[model samples]
Target: MNTMTLWHISGWGFAALAFAALLVGFSKTAVSGANTVSLAIFAAVLPARASTGVLLPVLIAGDVLAVLTYRRHAHWPTLWRLFPAVAAGVVVGTLFLVWADDGVVRTSIGAILLLMAGVTLWRRRRAESADGADEPDAVTSRAGRMKARSYGVLGGFTTMVANAGGPVMSMYLLSAGFRKLGFLGTSAFFFLIVNVSKVPFSAGLGLIDGRSLLLDAALAVFVVPGALFGKWAVNRINQRLFEQLVIAATVVGGVQLLLR
Candidate 1:
């Protein structure tokens, strides 16, 4: 591969990537489902397929920070229940990647982002309507099992395809009545394991290589500060306002990709 392929990014493009990398860390530590914006920015700045590869390592870095901060709060049983279905979905997603070209992937990612945003808004409205009637854990009952399996597979596929699985998993956790700390903790561990697992598949697909890794190295520095800032702000931040911002940014990014 020509070195220029990696280094061809302009200073402004690099700045954008650096900002996206920071958001990756911030999303991991503070807002569980906010990184869809990062995903959109990355895809816009780089080739769609290559963007996923370059973003994976940075996500892992953020995941590590999140896990360290919230490791104790993770719900193990939920993770166990979801893993098999998620693995199956990952395999299907790999097959899809084998078939898709860059343009198709880009369009698919844009669609997925928009769909996830819609789902999140719907879930939130439902949650508000239900109020105090928090549903029981979705990993125990037969209906819950089916629900987990459905979400697990969808989460796996979305994450594998576009690094857009956060919203799916967030919906699952919220529906299952995860408190804030538990949600963050479970999400932190789930993504760390899943994103790390994706490395070999991405490598096999040639999405990750020397050039992508080189770009990752350069962008990674920004993740640490972002994570630290998120950690500092997580408790103080206004949840409603932040979520609104996340949703708005996601819509814009999704529209841009679809139109592009």
Candidate 2:
């Protein structure tokens, strides 16, 4: 209960961590806001700085699993195109992390998430109206390019500060017209590369350390089951509905991050 005790570890807290990991798994595979919930939970259980470090490895673990599950489904062209801009955004976010107030950071992240969620919802709605039980032209292009530069930049900035990169990328893929597995797979790989790349940056920021890594090692156990379950759930659910779930969760999580 004391601050010192929290700093070490909490057994029931691991349970809390596992529950959050389950959310992370779901978010990684189904929704984009899972990180927001996991981030808040980890921050509550550990120090904010410590929590970010601790959660990063576990996320990478989940990212690996998701990438494996959906590896073949990624839209590589979109991913490749987004890389430079995303990297640029990451630098911007890392810089922002250096001096911004936590409240300001959360609010900005929340606002972006909320806005992306809204856009995704509207697009999906239109996609459904345009056609159903069949893939639309919008979601099926290989060289589809419009907002790649803009989305990539925003996605990078969001992910860096609040680990909010998932939704940013989610909206990008959604607008580009990727299917569920493709979206999940592309997101999986993109974050894998991006999140892994962040280790050094995060380290420089002192957002990662020994205690946090140990905790990540311990909590990584929960993500597999969550991913498996999400995989199954997505298979049976209607694609539109499944994405709506993710978008709705995004709005809630986004708002929470901003309001918190």
Candidate 3:
């Protein structure tokens, strides 16, 4: 396609992408799993591989907004513990992209997300049964070095492959007993660093280019409103409801990806 043709998008396509971008901001600032909707929309609207590139800048913009809103509540110890393993996972995901087709990428990420959602739900159930209640401590143990590393690796790989890190990290944070603000704050920072790091790798792989950048610029404008809406929602939503919603979204998103 010509440059103009490549850049040109239909009204509905633009609207879909704009909504996806808004979801990015909302997910960053409030309900983390809502981003699965954004990812699915991007992949539907663009090539699977190319959509990740287009979404990255928009994610970073949301991350920046989230950081500004919840920077004070982040827990650095967990982030520090996860960094090395997360980096390794990113490398592995990068290597996978070298030979993997779009179908493989979609199905692989889908399966992973489904499995993770199952695990998170199962664990939560087990804890509730054991304690007769779903207390934070019962649901999630303290983040030890090993646990952090394992989740880190998974988070890195998923995020790198499909921008699906939010679910992985959300499960981890919930398990670790982080309340809403702390969870959002930590997630905001983690994604900012990771997404920025991926930029060079994506550009090198030709996933990012002038065309994608132009689209991202348009999408970025909607993120602010979404972020603002998220901030408002976060204050009112109950913890249990939030977690349940996230898990449901993750499962649905994974299924969509697999079938796509």
Per-model TM-score, in order, reads 0.95, 0.80, 0.85
**Residue range with the least summed lDDT across 10 consecutive positions in model 3:** 131-140
TM-score comparison, 1 vs 2, better candidate: 1
* True lDDT of residue 20, candidate 1: 94
Off by over 4 Å in 1: 1-7, 130-138
Q: Report the C-alpha lDDT of model 1 over 1-260, residue by residue, as the tens digit.
A: 33237446889999999999999889999988788999999999888877888889999999999999999989999999999999998999999999998889999999999999998898788667764322237467999899999999999999999999999999988888887788889999999999999999998988888877878998889999999999999999997888888899999999999988
Please, what are the lDDT tens digits per residue for candidate 3 over residues 1-260? 22234345679988999999998888888877678778877776776777778889999999999999999988877777778988998898888877787788778767866876786677567545552312233313454666888988988998888888877787777777676677788888998999999898777767788877887898999999999999998878674676687678678877988898
Residue 257 displacement in candidate 1 (angstroms): 0.8
What TM value does model 2 have?
0.80
lDDT of 2 by residue, 58-140 (tens): 88888988888889887776678889989999999889878875456556656766776776776667656653322312423
lDDT (Cα, 0-100) at 164 in candidate 2: 64
When 1 and 3 are scored with lDDT, the better candidate is 1
| Least accurate 10 contiguous residues by lDDT in model 2 | 131-140
Model 1, residue 218: C-alpha shift (Å)? 1.5
The TM-score that candidate 1 achieves is: 0.95
What ranges in model 3 sit over 4 Å off? Answer: 1-8, 123-143, 238-250
For each candidate, the alpha-carbon lDDT, in order, equals: 0.89, 0.71, 0.79
